[model samples]
Target: MGRTTWFDDDGLKKGEWTAEEDRMLVAYINEYGLGDWRAMPKRAGLQRCGKSCRLRWLNYLRPGIKRGKFTPQEEEDIIKFHSLLGNRWAAIAKQMPNRTDNDIKNHWNSCLKKRLFRSGIDPVTHEPVVNVKATSSSTMSSPTLTPSSSTTDSSTSSARLLNRLAAGISSRKHGLDRIKNMILSEPRQAVKEDKLMISSKEDEEEEVNGCFMEIDDNLISTTSLDELLCEPYDMYQSDLGHEIDDQLDLFLEIHSLGQDLS
Candidate 1:
């Protein structure tokens, strides 16, 4: 069946309605109740179309219609509901008792949508917008340093080991930055990835320490008692060498216990 046209052949009134037209619409609805809107203008002596009349009555002249600015709670709920339901304004209106779908939609487009964008949030997805450039720049600026050359001398090797330790700290800092980006961009995935990264790093540390323990035990056990006694006196000659000896001792002690367990 063809849909009945509510608009008149000569075109019904299109602009702002007069006070008399408002009164007539209210009077007609009150006396006869809201019947078929298509035939309403003719019966009520109104020049407006059925759609216009319906909108005017529902949005403006309807009882209990809160016409003022929306409250903070209503604004919050609209954003929350819109995130869950998308553009289902009618469904959103159901939760807001005094609001219409049109008002809710207008408020979102005019206000909430822009607000979300400004706050780095994707209105459609309701997720934080990741700044790719920021992440890239941060990572590029903090390049991980590597040992420039290899040497068999114990002093040079110790210096390289210290450099590698510093590099490891830098790598962990980068890892933390990536985690921060993930959290902002995708929270649920970030949580899972965070757990996995922590566990993997822990396991890596254990394996690395196991290897270090074996190396440390071999180095300590192979050294002559005379070298051990002389090394401390040699370390005392310079502050830098003293620091190196102290660090090496601490590192070996920590890993030596791990060797016993193996």
Candidate 2:
């Protein structure tokens, strides 16, 4: 036997719901409360499907529904929750009080993804998105899980090396404090290097043109030797002559060391 449809020919007024239909629905539900949603449209004199009416009332016409742009904090919470929950928008929305699942999904697709990309995060993976310093697409994928077992092995080894370096530094030791200071000083050191490079280049150009510009050795510090060695760092060695092999080695070592320590 064929399943009978709930909607009757005489039951429906057969068009979009009017103000009268909405009022009737509101009055009926207020008096009787919602029961058997498939039977609601006929009982309440609405033209729309019972499913459609229920959705419209719950999502759009609900008394305490909030309809507006999400605040920055709300957006951040949504992103954090989404990173953990992975598209369970309904569950996330429930925590957001008046916000709907549809709203959250649209915001993620249209806005949040761009924000994540701008902040150097992989929107899909929710991990720090780094530029590939190497040429191969293999380098584009995460070092932890690659098609090449050798690559994975190398990555693991590199992580161990980094952990050793980290373990070598103790909080009570002056060496650890020195390293922390060095790390914090890196940006300032970079800016100083840029200024020195620019000044040196300008002086060289002036000298070649039979003019003189004052050169100052005091402008460049001898203290930041490591940072100076890695000056003008860019992905794929755009500024410096960073080799693809070197880049791969660096990444593998870093990843391996990280894993080892953890």
Candidate 3:
């Protein structure tokens, strides 16, 4: 047998498919039924690559294909599956019987992503966006005074410190929430460090105050609190000392102001 013409060597047509091309593709598929994609375009007498022909038919010309807007349920399903499956568009498409991967992917990029972002949800991670700047600035710049060493101390001192720092600053609530969320979102090691810092009364008051002083020194020396938080910290060290001190000072100032008013 002579060499079979598998595909046309001519430059394949691209961009918008003509009305005539659609009819040709539809007619070819109707009569012959779908076959090998690589040879389909050549056999159908279309100046298109097999891949292009395949996409056109599957995404547009296929029987029972839904071409209108997706339903609300479909939209919810897309978001739900996207959260679980990430950008596996084809896998997400399969969950909706009548949808195509291209349609779902387009919808996500064009509409869903913006919608989620505006709602304060990270569309990719499907989680609330931590306002790191707000948290870092509020915590780093404002120093709160700790109660005098004579005041009651307990294993829960760290927790008390956070509460005191947040006290009397109604506007700082958002920043405090962001910090709590960040701590919760951190790995188990960070969680453990948080507990240790809160519970560790092993150090003498002098040692603890010395450490606080060192952190204050660093905060005074550094220009950017954001950079400091992002830097690597030793597993044993709590990186939030300066922030705590700032909050502590603010707390004490607020208390003294209340006393002065009284």
Question: Which one wins on lDDT?
Answer: 1
Which candidate, 2 or 3, would have the higher TM-score against the true structure?
3
Return the top candidate by TM-score.
3
Of 1 and 2, the candidate ranking higher by lDDT? 1
* Span of 10 residues, lowest total lDDT, candidate 1: 191-200
Query: What order do you get sorting by TM-score, best first?
Result: 3, 1, 2
Error of 3 at 237 (Å): 42
- Per residue, candidate 1 scores C-alpha lDDT tens digits across 160-180 of 233222222223433424423
lDDT of each: 0.53, 0.47, 0.52
lDDT of 2 at 162: 25
Per residue, candidate 2 scores C-alpha lDDT tens digits across 1-262 of 2233354575644435556767888887887897888888778766667777786677666678788898999999887656544455675676687888888889998999779867766454354544523323343432221111211111222222222222223112424344334434443332233111101222322211110000011211212223322332333245224322333343344333323322
Each candidate structure's count of clashing pairs: 0, 9, 11
What are the models' TM-scores? 0.48, 0.44, 0.48
Q: What lDDT does candidate 3 reach at residue 237? A: 24
Per-residue error at 76 for model 3, in Å? Answer: 0.7
